[model samples]
Target chain A: MRLKGFRLLTIITALVLSNNLLAQSIDDVLNRGQVHGNFGMDMQYYQVDSLIGASETPDEDVLMNGFANFIYTNGSFSAGFRYESYMNALQGFPAQYKGNGIGYRFASYTNDDMTVTVGNYYEQFGNGLIFRTYEALGGLGYDNSMDGMRINYKLRDGLFVKGIIGTQRLYFEQGDGVLRGVDGELMVNDFFGGSLKNSKTKLTLGASFISKYQADQSSQYNLPENVGAYSGRFLLRHRKISFNGEYAYKINDPSADNGFIYKEGTAFYAETAYSTKGFGLTLSAKGNDNMSFRSDRAAGQQDLLINYLPALTRQHTYNLLATLYPYATQPNGEMAFQGELVYKLKKKSFLGGKYGTGILVNYSTIYNIDSTAVPTAENDSTRMGYTTNIFSVGDERYYDEINVEITKKFSKKLKGIFTYSNMVFNQAVIQGKNPKKYPDVYADIAVIDLTYKINKKNAIRTEIQGLFTQQDQQEWATILIEYSFSPHWFVAIMDQYNYGNTNKDVDGNFNERIHYYFASAGYVRGANRFQVGYGRQRAGIFCIGGICRTVPAANGLTLSITSSF
Target chain B: MKKLILLSILTTLSFTIFSQQEKRAMPSVNVTDMEGGTVNTSEFNNDGKPMIVNFWATWCSPCKRELNNIADVYDDWVEETGVKLIAISIDDARNAGKVAPYVNGKGWEYEVYIDSNQDLKRALNVNNVPHTFLLNGKGEIVWQHNSYQEGDEDTLYEAVKALAAGKELKH
Candidate 1:
């Protein structure tokens, strides 16, 4: 690995020097070599549980993790590498990430009609039902860079094709399997020229096929010698409405999680939305079962997800109860539906008053499918692709939520929002394993947020939220305050209290109750910014940018600085 | 504790001073046009012309609507204010081939360019999609809006006419 790192660095150096010479030197350091990096250390000292689940707790320690990325881009040529080191890395971010090395290394070139990339790269097909790479940064950790090559070709008019071949990366090492795929897309109006261009209706068609080759291991018997999967999608847009959907099916493969036998799986997802002047609406549906299609079947969430299964439920970011019963996509036997509506009130209407108002309502539900109908006697020997009824629907519900929100601006600087939500979540799927035998039930939530500008230079924003439930823990409350001045700085303070807990300890104290408080401030000046915060944070499910991860509880201070030159 | 309070006061005072001095930072650019010729912003004037510069992506749905909505009124915009609109695409090579065709297919008369590397985006601080910036003939950025509403362009046009006629904007 060290030798490989040296080779990659040498190549980058050579590419930088050559590319710089090709371009006119702007200064002593050529403009061709544009370097940018992010360097920050999150040092957190943790106090162990000291009681239950305290088996692996270290006495007192400070954990630090940081990384720097540098890139040199000029014209059509670019190359970059990233260096990372985590001394006692964050609890949830993979422990094997402790070693210092070039986690990501890549080089690329592109022109008007063609582009090529060698080494590491990230790419995704439509909605990522077939393939997707790169991390979501704060939310998910599936950064599966290919250790090979990718090329894209632009054929006449609106036709484009992309092809890639390589072994997916698993942390610092390559996975045992090889992945190869190709995607082709067509913009309908582009092919027919002038007449089609004038048409109000537009259409786009895309297809992608990915195949994996993994050598058979002794632990699994009768594994498919070569596994292949194919997916296709189409998008249509006419005036104010649009629709898109993708479907995928995979050959049988055996893994420890599946009891060492092959079981074919399929997935389908589709969504349609319409919008005009002040209103927008969307409806979506998905069906997936035994289709947790990761590149390395044995690997968990550690850098091996090939395709992404978008959750059909809304992601909440509040502290306490917001995450208490979050819904995670169950890749085994589930069907789901989601709908949303948003409308903005007219300025002169009675409810709209002067500044106008906006209202939004959303609902989502997921249900389990009955699989007992499949004959158990033929499941072991038959090879007819795990017989599934072509258009059958399931009846058992796994999760559901309904949320409504109203926003009104009393004046230019004084605005407020009110929201109410009702939800039912299945802990059996969300938590992977049910700690409590009984599944979680429904809950009610409410939130009110208001902002007031005291003057031209000072402003304040506040939020009050509550969640009421009957299972596990009961009621929760949160209060937040923020003060800001334009173009420079802001500070925020928040606290959450779980005052209603059902369980009491031996001393008659609320064992389930927990209190958390945090204060943070940010300063922005030009391209450089700094933010720092400190407090006790209760562990919860965090979803940022559509990806979800569980964050562990901690008491610590954090400092972050980002700048570009 | 008194010292901490004093420090906080100083910080607030300094921030207020900074805010008072806040002036919009503008950049001078000579970007290459779709026809492969350089057009300097400082020299380009609307001259009573209502110009629309739209930043868009091939995958964003709202941007498509804004473009189509303008396309429906593009001829009128030209006849009314001699407006010249330009649509800049941020699609990389993976989807770059679709831009020109997509524009042509939509039959939009607006000028288009490919900012594949996003240099223009960084300069404009475009942190989100479907962002639009409206400039007056004096080449000064008179107004700007983030995201779009169905009839936002109408409001934008009214501002343009007022600015072109040397009248104060109603805001």
Candidate 2:
């Protein structure tokens, strides 16, 4: 007992001395050193209900997901680590994330024109068609960081080079494949150094090469041990007009996503835009064939993806339209086109009123590429599989959207925004569900959002939205009201009603028509925020930045907290 | 249970230390312009004037609302404070092409840049859009706020005003 007490006293004295030393060190580097971090927690309590298809409530009844990042930087040296805890995770997240661990940790330093990083890192090369490692953990939990070394060198003012060698993260563990890549970019005008930089037109060129190596362990087919992909990009800008293009090519890659087909992949993306005082226009087009590249050959779905294929569709913001029919890029083969126009009406005009009117028109479409199947002998699956033409577009339409929006300020204290969207969505092909069960859905959505300011410290906003469709659920109406007391507090209530259910049951009765209601309150102080809500969540596909995941229907009380320092 | 207790203790300790620390300078990171040119954020200086850096996206409604509200009173704020606002869009390649035209249509007079790959966002530890940061004359990150409510800009403007008048903020 005496020894134990002495040990405790010694420990306490040491801790106090260390604390003082830490404080003094911080003060010494106070001008140059800084530490910052952020933390987020999301917790939910679930209740099972069969009427709305929410029957998979966990036995624990309560689950939480949380992450925290702490970074310390002084001068050109920096270090950080992120701790993530998914205590059984949320309902829709992958089950592989079962416990707590350090998901990301990195240390880096910059000297003159060079920067070197070691440990876990995220990176992207040219449009992310060839390679990208990132984290998008909001609605859809997708994180693929790399564990290795990265070097960035600035040869000159306008020339830069990057080199990376690593193994990508697969859930909580590193994948089996090894990745190596190099990318270089140069600005032609700036490279020439003096007067050329002042020219009206600017030219930039970039190229990247990436390769992955995984041992061939498949018993059926002989897969290549190493696969390489290369891409070249160019950008030209003159005055208010800019044009950008990139083309990527990959050697034969056999992966699970492609059904083990050994076919070379190719992709091309091009975009041009013209912007002036009151009018701006943009056009973009892309063609991709067999472009699914993953670190693990057997990985499927949103796992171990090494590249990104952007979905060429308008991202709707309305509640019903966004949730009803969201599209994901078909990496096998696709051709897409998008166009947008933005115009502003002058103030003091008949249509503009006292405040200038803003108008936006956008249209986008994606279709399958033309492909012909190759004949194979019985029990012979070792062939090129199929042939696809680059320019030929097939008749199967994956997704299409046409939208228009108008924004106007009616008075000093009132403003309004109106939007209309027409969408043609093929849920069967996009969601990989049975086509015969879920037919094509054509929808028209309209939204009107208005905000009224009562004074400098108080305001109220309202949103009324409706979706009209002849297929899948028939129709939906949503109303949302939000009131803000300024700087610190906010409260909101929203209700979505499925009023038109055309499907009939065996008894010749209409399907269930239900309302998903949600109410939330939030408080904020400086860089910290706390919010709580209770709601009935509808089953649908939740997407952000073209990546998507399915969320099951649930009834729950939720709490979210976030803070940064 | 031990981990939870340790986390709580760390949280309390960090809060106290953070409140006592001095202001921190902004980190230097690379971001893209509308024309696809790379620009170092370290060069983002305004001749010893205050600046507001806002992170937003094309699909975020709350972000749009906040920017629109600030746009209405931007000119007055600028004239009063000599302040500049830089809008950074975190739109990836999918929607990055729309940022320039969208800004033009809204007729906003703020300078805009694109963080297509979210490099700057990650460097600054920004978790969400509609996050805004305020910088003092010496390019020190004086204050920041997450999310946005109706009159949050008023509080932001007040901070800028205090900085301009050489008054220390109370947090």
Candidate 3:
């Protein structure tokens, strides 16, 4: 195996050396370039509480997570780097993110129709089915920025091409696999601008090919050294109607996630939307079969993932609905479908008052892909572990949800939002829970959010939410109130109570009814903001495909500061 | 590695300290329009008038509120100060398709674009949604603010008016 050094994402750009710069003094030259960056820091102080299993806390007591980025851009050249430090990272973050250094940096130059970059960067191909790399939110502690060289150019008026040769970043180190990829796109209307450019119909076509190379060191099986994937996508639009779809396929490569199965992977997604003034309708579908593609086959759980598979579902923002039964996309194999309708009732009409009312109806579901195991008789002849019928949904259901929301302006100074959701969460399937330990959760959630304007700079907002379910923790109710002193300050308080507890503890006793409470205040001025809070519950965790981490019950004071310049 | 990083940092510092005075300009970055066409941030123009660049998303409640609130008086803002608002949605590909329809459903008469990969968001150093920046006629970012409350857009409008009147904004 070959070892490659130099893992940096910052751009060390080549400054301009034109004769025009020689005439200017140092101050003049330096003052021409602009510098911009942002800083964010999160620190939490913990208090031990034995009730919710927080009896012991870290010796550090106060854990901090922070980062700052500095970028300077002048004309066509830009260079920047990010500095990250996690003094014992915040709770529920990926364990790998210890003390961070420079996570991302890049230098790039764009001239004429071409641009070149060396160092760390993020890139994505059509729909990111074939290849994609990016950094998650700071608190997520997930980043897969690439360290390499990327060149993008406009081949013609409507034709564009890009190529990347790099390796994925894994924590502070680089992945074992080397990656190379190329992408090309064509705009039909722009390419042939005679009549097509002015026509109401618009069309775009694109294709991407990516391959990864890794050394074979396994003694158990002969692994493929080079694994490649390719995809094609197109978008068509005519007036108010738009349609787009992408299909990707990868060569057979045995990996740990698939039990070393030699089944080739295929995935495809398609969506169509029709929208007009005050009304929008959309439907989308996707099928994934062994679509998990990672730089290092040995890596596990979001490590070195080279592609993104979006779970076709509504990302609820409400507290109970978002945290409780959210469905994660099953990458290995799943068939998902979603449809939504967003419409606004006309003013002075039924259900609409002086101001119009906004209505949203959404339904989404996911099911396992149908697959049949290969006969043991011919298993070794061709090690294709199983065969799947494309888009064929299996009998087992993974997740299903239907929700509706109504936003209305009741009076001149009063507004309200009401939402209701009915979900059938396959806890045993989606969360990989034992059937005996947890049953399928059938839940109904309702939320009422209201805001009243007391004056120009003063307003009050309230939220009343309830979740009723027979499985997992029973029923819960919550209430929140916020006071806003506009242009500067805001204070809010919230309390969540587990009213109905039907589940038994490990000691065969009833679980404690913990009324998780929190209070916070914040001040914002210009581009800087300061927030201080006392909380007793952790935020929601993102569990992509049933892989979830337990968010410890927290009791602490939190301080967060953010600034941009 | 540490030495190399340190050296690179020094070079950038020197460039920034000497190159430009205190003028902050929008970085040139590419984002996709609703029509799948790539639009460069540097190409944003409003006929030599002040422009409001707002970074928002569909899932953010405060962002939705701010945009909706502005929509009610957008025509007045234009007539009074000729300020053009460009709402940039940072929705990833998963919800990119819903952006156009969602924007229309809400009846917001503002220029909208999708930063599907957050290229523009990162370039502008935006920490969270509702992060907004005001640019003068010359395209220099003059003032910026983040987060939103019920009446926050009023404060933003005041700055836009000041910028339109060629008044120095108190940052």
Expressed as tens digits, the lDDT of each residue in A1-565 for candidate 2 is 9999897778666665665566456545664667889888778898787656778688888998889989888888889999999987888888888799998999999999899999999889888898988886644567899899999898998999999999998879989899999999998988887898888899999999999999999777788989999999999999889898999999999888887777799998999988887788989998899999999999986888999888877776667877778888888999999999999899899998898888889999999999999876523446677998867899999988999999888987888889999999888899887999888889999999888888987888888989999987889998888888888888888888888877678998776677888777888887788877788766454221111223444478977777888
In terms of lDDT, model 2 sits at 0.83
TM-score pick, better of 1 and 3? 3
Which stretches of candidate 1 lie above 4 Å from their native place?
A1-33, A37-41, A48-60, A138-140, A320-322, A373-387, A539-553, B1-171
Model 1 C-alpha lDDT per residue in residues A335-400, reported as the tens digit of each score: 888877767677789987895677777788888765644435433533333445423566767888
Q: What DockQ, between 0 and 1, does each candidate earn?
A: 0.04, 0.33, 0.39
The candidate, 2 or 3, that scores higher on DockQ is: 3
Number of the top DockQ candidate? 3
- Candidate 1, residues B13-126, lDDT tens digits: the string is 444434332112223233434322234343445564545667777545446546765775778777866767777776543333334444544455787776654545544545
lDDT: worst 10-residue window of model 3 chain A: A542-551
TM-score, prediction 3: 0.92
The lDDT, on a scale of 0 to 1, for candidate 3 is: 0.83
Query: For model 2, how does the per-residue alpha-carbon lDDT over B58-164 read when each residue is reduced to its tens digit?
Result: 88777887897898889998898889999999888888888887887677788899988787887788877678999988888889888877778899999999988
Tell me which residue pairs clash in candidate 1. A197-B105
